[model samples]
Target: MSSTAERQGGSPGGHPRGLYFLAGTELWERFSFYGMQALLTLYMVKQLLLPEFAENVWGLAALRGMAEGMFGTLGNVGFASVIAGLYSGLVYFTPLLGGLIADQLLGAKRTVTIGVLLMSAGHLAMTFDQLFVVALVLLILGSGLLKGNISSQVGTLYPQDDASMRDRGFAIFSTGINIGAAAGPLVTGAVAAIWGWHAGFAVAAGLMLVALATYLAGQKHLPDTPPRRHADFQHPPLSKADGKVVLALIAVILLTMPAEITYPMVWTIGPIWVDSYVNLGFVPATWFGSMDSIGAIASAPLLVMFWASQARKRREPDSLGKMAIGTGLVGVAALGLAAGSFIFPAKDSVPLIWAIACYFLMGVGWMYYWPTTLSLVSGVAPRAVVATMVSGAFISPFIAHLAAGVIGINFKRMSPSAFWAMDGAIGLAGAVLLFALRPMLNRALGTDKRKDAPENAF
Candidate 1:
């Protein structure tokens, strides 16, 4: 369907039918991904890395030796954190390759299909103890293929001029992400607790199959991929202006990395923290990983409504402003953790309310920045390289996860308050830098002219 037709003939709720389908695909994909992620660190620390199980996994010894050689001796938790960081970081990093493949070779649809199949295989591989590393590799490769292309397609669902609708559409799509993220850990964690970890992985594999089916069912509704081009592909030259815009986008992405670095702690070491220090009664520690998603899911609609109201009053912050605000909020959330640690120094003494508050703030921060970043890229990126740019945007998270991993190694060595305070400092510094660089960024991104214009004018 043409973008014009899709927009004009949108569903009763005024969105293209394909949006929901894509969102549904993302929902299931995230369900599987997050389900596995919620289990990964805990599984490693408690089961997989133990001598009885670790010896069974092929090549694990070599992998451990290599990691230790680079980062010094790592006990089980520290090693798990590093592996989780590498896995998480690589997951985002691969999108750059996936984007290129989609743009130059296979086109988005075919690439996405391949991604889904690989991810499904990865999830199934998780069912076998010996296939742990193999499973991670498959999942990373598959995510690299799927993430950027799927998101790029969402931008194609709307008329190029309809930036407002497109932004709202991304918000809606992100809602699907949070929904799956919220539910995945809850369901899978419970399953693992009751029936063991492999059973949880089996469930993820099943959900991934459902994601593939959803994408297939919606294929006709999705935008058709343009024919792949290979001749002179190595150098798709751009105008001077487009080149500047690309550089500006990269800067913005880099500035966002500090906030990104703060994010993985909630998943990588978060479960372990909760398991060791929080009094949860019967609740699984992995359930804490879902708190941010739940907060995001609840707040998304309210945020959209709030932004809409501001738009009507001609007082809405621009995308850059929103991002700065988001980054600040993430920093504040981290500070909240630091405060909790200081006040409740005894193990498991931290109030549950404090952790919940931290996750809630982080969720709000994510909503403010992430969707805005996606919408900005979709709207302003040169058409020739939009998909590639979208994928490149994910590089922030890639950098963040790698850094987070390195920083996480200190989790065992430092006091909780000190560690969290350091993270808070990083996020706050990024927010300050982004705010200071706003004018330069706006001019470079060519958004200076639209600063005082209507939100839709962009």
Candidate 2:
């Protein structure tokens, strides 16, 4: 899926090599992402402390007898929750800086490399307790650069006429993310468990190095998918009316991020009011935050195919329509959160099935939300700054998180039930806004389907 659809040079075994470059790069990139996720929390709560192996070390003695239990000598919940949420949250939030470096100076390729190097360095830095703060910074920066740019490059592989392949490309790109996320944990978790968390970072760096090597080896395959230069891509002619629509979308995204961040940041505010309403809030918070990813993983391929089929029938959803629905569903998922909290009452875990159900429902909803936004952004952005535009897409969440962290810390005094309800209410607002703007979006961007185009469904 390169920019040029001419497919010169004998089709390279019937498909462009850029696909492999993206596929491999993403695979390794996800490994790093997931690796960090698996161990990040444990690292912060346990590894960074004086006894690196306290959980395993301390728990080993208690295990002389039969069953596994939640309690023994354990880290404090509030402090640990903050650390875990912040680490995961910051990774999303800091991409703003990463996106900037990539756009202005590094380009996606170099940006990814620098990010990986920093990641490896950060992982290594974990060995020194004093360096933990610095290590976290590097890891966040690396993820920010790598996450947004790599996907942008994937889109760059196709020309505007080729919208059909976008979904497929995103699907493949996302697969790389999941693969990395899934593997990073399995591999790093084991390594950290036995050798040390530092060892896991070393392994993550090695994976990134390998990913880079794979990209280099496959560079020739991506000749048609050359890095986008500024000044080529142009915005669709924007009149005052069109400009208003664009502004509206910006507003929608801005509002959406805080709501999105709240899914993960709930506990930050829940404690003050949670005791009065639900017995245990973590169960719901974790479920909602984690639901999006798990849902993305589960539904990506299925939704891609479904959308492709719709496009074939010429009944495809335009970008705005997709966003509208996706946004609505996110809001709907928030309602589910509200209900579960209500049903559980007095600090209890909602039925495990409720969490699973929420994950599945939200997963499908996000499937529509993210790729559609990306496709819409691609359609509207000037080709010259599409890289930067895409970088901005990644940056939006970071900005949102900075706001969320502050808001979350302060919002705790409110009731937990009210808190969950408010989250749902906001998502609904985004959906409505996006839906209302659909006509403008369709007029601005043209049809969303390019089924016969070089780009595949993302």
User: lDDT of all predictions, in order shown?
Assistant: 0.87, 0.58
Candidate maximizing lDDT: 1
The 10-residue segment of model 1 with minimum total lDDT is 449-458
TM-score of 1: 0.91
Query: Residue-wise lDDT of candidate 2 within 17-94, one digit each (tens)?
Result: 577677888788777666655555445444444344433333223331211142223333333444445566678756
Tell me each candidate's TM-score.
Answer: 0.91, 0.69
lDDT of 1 by residue, 290-391 (tens): 898888888877997998888888778888888988888899898998898888878888878778889888999988888788778867999888767777
Candidate 1 overall lDDT versus native = 0.87
